[model samples]
Target chain A: MRYEEFKEGIRDGIPICLGYISVSVAFGMTAVLSGIPVWAAVLISLTNVTSAGQFAGINLLVAQGTYLELALTTLIINIRYFLMSLSVSQKVEENMGMGKRLATAFGITDEIFAVSMQRKKRLSAPYMAGLILTPVLGWTGGTLIGATATSLMPPILSASLGIALYGMFIAIIIPPARIHRSVLYAVLLAVAASCCFYYLPGLKKLSGGWSIIIITVAVSALMAWKFPVSPEDEEDE
Target chain B: MEQIRIGYLLGGIAVMAAVTYIIRMLPMAIFRKKIDNVFIQSFLYYVPYTVLGAMTFPAIFYSTQSVPPAAAGCAAAVVLAYRGKGLLIVAVGAAAAVFAVQLLMNIIIV
Candidate 1:
């Protein structure tokens, strides 16, 4: 076990935790505004670390969306994690046991996946724990602060901080898109696809959760076909 | 019972957590062997970028009090991040940009 890897993983996760805390703070405010109790709001963040899925789930709960609707909506929104987990699994050392693997899987958010993928070695249990620890706490911790301090938090500050999570994501993707043509293509195609879903009335009627699923899968497949990664790029796995 | 009720809320969160965990768990547990397929590997590689792209668009534009302020924040993130700033700096800068624009807009509108 490389204590070095674990330390490095913690360092890498700090930014993610910062990003997560701010957004989950926004979510915390949202839950409070929606009449969700503070404890329940924190519970949601603790159990489900996903940004979109929790937002959608809370919206559904607020609007009285059926259980089937809740389940199906989250299922679609979280499908991206499956792809991430698969890619991450290829990197994880095979000697890892099932119980440890499950714990690691619980923590596989988009930021974690991105940071983990950049590692040029087999992902280890300790490294993943290091990666997972801060973000998980940041997410739940932010929610706690947000939920408990709604009256104290200025509306404008909470509102502004809401976009920080997406900012982190933009920061993550834009660098690669700027440097790589295929990545740029994938990014553009995804935007176009998302716009269509948003603007077209027939499609506009579809939920945001559904739009993400269709656009992500289709654009990823097209980019994969159009620009298959070279051997050198796949070296870490 | 309505979803807003405590019982429903608990049930809903449990179900959502279960679904999310299963989605994340099954792939790692099932795909034990090294996957050699080029197409699949590429597809997985592109998944993160594409997903982030789709989620960011249109939504980020509407995430704040109004579109212009949100746009300013996103632009700040893009510009700062393009210049290779740290993630904390980029995110904080974006939020500060949005807050500043929002403050200015309130001054103008009032």
Candidate 2:
């Protein structure tokens, strides 16, 4: 049973691997373009497995930003994953120990958490191992392809494909937004809050990391206040 | 351009990986018991959508060369995603739309 569940996790990770390739290709190109070593680029993907945080870290590194700044920026940008894991932690198999839980948490990217949460029961070790395996392979593998293929890749192609990662982001939210009016409203609120943070004369000076923190927390808080989802509303992801 | 010092680069990655990993690990490892708090549950439930949205818009609008192609790509994604296409298909659709528009725009400019 555990093996089957593990296999299912790997099976579900297929599309995510594809999406990771498209996005990580851009990151690989960006890292090399920024003059980062290919090994470092791949290492970032291997260790971090985060898109926004890696991008932000790379940008800061290129600009020779302070170490404190870089770390804080990464923390803030990847903060959402904390929430993701918190939710997933609740759903982790009760028998699972701290070690295995930590191992599973290492794999808790946004998509992984979402799919795992959709499971009807507490997540099992085999299932999580299977789920995380392909995407980890995909993430590092894509980075390798990107970092090495730097010379052959056309600038235009890389730029055009940059949209693919964002496209995946669209895939995540749109269905929920469409099916749930509250989600739609939360999305709109997030966008509106983001725009204000971007454009408002006084607020515009806030850094990207800080703004993301604000937008995520504020919009979620407001939605929770106004919408107040019942236990069932939050059911099955 | 001056390159980032090698030590700093490694340190930065370590910091990022450590912090990001810790942030993820702490919750998953420590939260052995379930939270019965309603507000926190509701708040956590909405966090994913809000974060995705906060990342997408405004950022997506400028991800490409200009608004026209980027808009084309995003519109394709939104439409296809709304229609329930798989993520892989949606991403391909968006990238292809942007590529097509960019090609035409290049031709027009030249």
Candidate 3:
């Protein structure tokens, strides 16, 4: 890649990196508090790069969750990425090869996609590559710091750091929820499902992983099928 | 035995990386042809929002041992977000509300 391209990628990736750092620190702290070894926590963050799935998976692992349970749960939570990937495919150059496409897929997180989609032109491979690599490093780096320093940081500070993850989630969800009526419905449905899962009998005992997957897919699919985004609205982007 | 455990952990990481790569890579690889299907395209657009809502809403209220605080916080955040507050403001506001509510709950319960 040319130096200019590399520089551009770094420029585009900085905000994403900052966001990842805050979110990953919370993940690391939660993992440590749950009694997982710090290194294990770091490894999970590095590999998963997913906030909800990793959090749910860790809870299951702590409870001695089965492999099937873990897989199903993570799948449910991450089902959204499948859609995100499909949307991103539209932005990729028409002639882009499979290898580059696959590489780009690894970096297709919510923030990265938001930034990428906003671009006026087709996305470049090097720029996407840079976007993916920087955030991965930031997340892993944040996890490492949080895990290694769990004991060193005071309790209040760790508690505050935990808030960072919630902050990041709010950042992601609120923007779209405000602008789109359908998104608002999806959020409400998810909140209601969570309440039902927490309060209702039998469902209360359902694994966290499964709960996330089920609630997400069922509600999302129902909404998509029933009230599709109109074609006229599509041109708003 | 310790060495074997380490091997297993590394093995897990490797496996996860490969699976993740494949999941992200397949569409880019297999569907080199344009996806002209309107239904499929629409499904792709709306699905991410649903997934995000699913992942996030639950966390707002449920964790090891609290509910009211998170619920209130989420409510506050939702209102603020709807009002067109920037992301940082909405998040900080929600988390702060949660923290404050939790403190109140602790006082009342005690």
C-alpha lDDT (0 to 100) for residue A173 of candidate 1: 80
The candidate with the higher TM-score, 2 or 3, is 2
Q: Compared with the true structure, what per-residue lDDT tens digits does model 2 show for residues A61-122?
A: 88888888877888877877877888788777787988899889898987777667556667
The all-Cα superposition gives candidate 1 an RMSD in Å to the true structure of 2.6
Q: TM-score (0 to 1) of chain B, per candidate?
A: 0.87, 0.85, 0.79
Question: Candidate 2 chain A: minimum summed lDDT over ten consecutive residues — where?
Answer: A113-122
Model 3 docking grade: acceptable
lDDT of 1 by residue, A174-237 (tens): 8778888888999999989998999998999887777787887899888889899966776723
Best by TM-score: 1
**Residue pairs with clashing backbones, model 3:** A73-A209, A76-A213
Candidate 3, what DockQ? 0.37
lDDT (Cα, tens digit) per residue for candidate 3, span A61-139: 6665555666666665565566567678876888877778877888877667755654555777877887778888998
Candidate 2: stretches off by over 4 Å: A59-66, A114-122, B1-9
1 against 3, candidate with superior TM-score: 1
